[model samples]
Target: MKPGTLHLIPSPIGSNTDVLAPYIRSILESVPYIIAENEKTVRRFLATQMSSELLAAKQFAILDEHTPFQDMPALLDPILAGQDGAIISEAGLPCVADPGSALVQLAHSHHIPVMPHPGPSAIFQTLMASGLNGQRFMFEGYLPIQEQERLARLRFLESLSSREQMSILWIETPYRVKSLFASLCRALREDTSLTIGQALMTEESFIYTATVGDWKKGAIELKKSPAVFAIQALPVAAGLRSNKSGGKAVGKPKK
Candidate 1:
């Protein structure tokens, strides 16, 4: 028999209401308990679509980084008693460097079903459009909040790009994009390749992927852009373990 269910529903990246009507119907009809990062924010965002009354009647609980682990039992008992719970982060997939992991771990240990409802994900989209080597890429989640730690992280990622021959995805808080980009240039090799994806799927947003040397000389700047950066570990090559290196890469130029 399947264990009591837990769902990881994908909310929109930056906007709420992007989930299609069929998806809304499916979630509303299926979920008995809703675990959200911010209930009021979600309520307002969903109100324009799902309406106020129904969303209210369906109770939601707050579960973020601060929620005590001991308190999880209280939340878990109700869920495991056959209440199918849905966890929605503010944006994108839960537990992708987000706060949904502890609850997920609790659910898995208790033999609960942890299902990921597939939908929009920016990281994959960035990699796909990046024109960078995607097969051996690593998503490092986000850059650090502290300057010292953030610089350290950047250096580490740059080393990963040089030593591993694997692409690395770098993310940052929206406000600090310029600082991060500046720091990235300092850390990476002039010829090291980088891909920048900003405000994906939106008319105002764009992506620019290229090498660091060209990036410094390019007209495009990510200073004001909300972006996800994917850095090519090494020049693109056919075989992963093969010692061959320095094959000239072919990719679309960024505008």
Candidate 2:
């Protein structure tokens, strides 16, 4: 029997299901099996796009961060046996920042054809509106939670951005949004440009770009919401100069 294909389905990041492509329903309806980050959440989302009977009839298997590597290959047995399957992320595109990548890799090893359906991604959405260097940017994902390590990583990223004139992007959990913003204000150069994309694609979405110095002048409550942060350091020749204290290039001007 011919090996079945694997479909990569992107889920909406927010309450709006309209962001999903119109062709997604047909893909969802055709797949007999699904691998998802969270079974409950996937079922909840499918309820919006599929009939109650159809949703109940679909078979689901979990493949999240906690899934052991040994157990992953079993998730593909049905597909390998000629039954088409789909992978759904908890939010946004599958396998970008999600754990679905492991299974996708396994599918590739077995020569299973993989098809990805385009949909909303918070990372690109933020970069598009950031007004930063769209030509060159890197997504750093999540920073270290330890204060000192996180600070060191921030400074290193800033230095790299300064030298290369590239943008750096990362994300934080909802509860840590304000805390991370505060840390960015303190750890980065005052002249560095920062962009905040909060609660994107939702009713409460807020996106703003400003220098670190400008952001420090006012206070805004970020509350607990998903946010993407981007930073572009001022070019070395623009204003950055060698620091006398640390012997490193400093982007902030002496106050």
Candidate 3:
């Protein structure tokens, strides 16, 4: 049996082809089959760009959270039997916040080889630029999208940022970004600094690092650029605000 390989291709966040050129060509020439989150978007992007290399008479299958579990046995059987395939997420790196965990677990259970091709990922990009503490950080992924769940998660993240002294990373739906930032303004330690990165490594990008108090006073307008954010943990200063209040801390740290 031929040894099969599973490649994780990390597509760009926004529409940028040049950044992904080398990887695209490699996949088209090498892999016989491809799995993707949105087959239509991939087709549309190839068509719009008039790229014959990646989408020229190529066949693809849609894969997502709803991908039937029963089909895994048959689908992955070929790979175990040894036919190489590539998996592409909607954006960023696969298996991060993306829904490739189950497929990966399947591969592991059967001892199939899974290889990754490193590329741009929003989570790491934000961390690199956020000026937050990358040494000890937590990637919280997307908080609950619904109001109650979102707030609950936000409250927990807020406490972690203040008390734990760790960088908190998060992403929200583009449209809800303004409101999410507003809530953070109401739920974080004062003097606690946050770095917000929007569209990292792409056109129309922006990054801001500032305190929660400055944010509440309209110092920064989040509406202009929606983004992934990192709130760096602060030192245990002398004037610590009540963890529940999440307001500004009033003084410097004790020596």
Candidate 4:
């Protein structure tokens, strides 16, 4: 029997489901089996897109951080046996910042085709609205939680960004958002550009970019919510000019 294909499906990062295109729904309906980060969340999302009867008939397997490496191959057994299957995350694209990359790699070794569908991703969306350098940027995912260690990492990223003129992106848990923002304000240079994207793609979404000095002037009260942060340090020449001018460097205005 011909090996079935594996679909890499993306889930909504926020309350907005309009990003779920019609084609994605069709693909979800076609697959008989699914591997997801959270079974309950996936089922709830599927229920919004398809009939309850159809959702009820689908088989699911768990694939999160705790899933053992040795057991991943078996998750693809149904697909290897000629049954179409998919991998979905609790939010955003699978295998990006989320889990399931290993299984996708195993599928390729077995000669199974992998197809990725488009959907909302907090990383990309944050970058898009950041007003920062889109041509060159890196997603650092999450930063170190330790206060001293995190400060070191922030300075390193700031230096790297200044040297390369690239944007550095990372996320923080909702509860840690305020603390991370506070750290960014303290550790980064005054003229460094900082962006905060909170609750992106939803009705309550907030995105703003400003210089570190400006952020310190009028601090915003950040609630405990999903957030992505990015920074773009001044280029070497710009840094020197700003320093000579008493730290008043023009940056992309807050948006």
Comparing 1 and 3 on lDDT, the stronger one: 1
* Residue lDDT tens for model 2, 119-164: 9889899999988999999999999988888888999999999999
Ranking by lDDT: 4, 2, 1, 3
Best by lDDT: 4
Of candidate 1, the 10-residue stretch with the lowest lDDT total is 235-244
Prediction-by-prediction clash tally: 0, 0, 1, 0
Model 4: residues with Cα > 4 Å off, grouped in runs: 249-255
Each prediction's RMSD over C-alphas, in Å, is 4.3, 4.3, 5.0, 1.7
**TM-score comparison, 1 vs 4, better candidate:** 4
lDDT of 4 at 87: 95
* TM-score per candidate, chains pooled: 0.83, 0.93, 0.83, 0.95
Query: What TM-score should be assigned to candidate 1?
Result: 0.83
Clashing pairs in 2: none
**Model 1, 217: alpha-carbon shift in Å?**
1.2
Q: Write the per-residue lDDT of candidate 3 for residues 12-114, one digit (tens) a residue.
A: 7788756665756566456666678898775664554445665665657777888887766566765666778778778888888887878888887877789
lDDT of 1 by residue, 123-238 (tens): 88888888777778898877887778887887778676667787889676778888887877777665567788888766666777766666766666464656788887553243
Displacement of the residue 157 alpha carbon in candidate 1, Å = 2.0
In candidate 4, what are the lDDT values of residues 141-245, reduced to their tens digit? 899999999999999999999999999999888999999988888799988988888888777888888888888876467768989999999998989899788
Give residue 218's error in model 1 in angstroms: 2.2
Candidate 3 clash pair list: 190-248
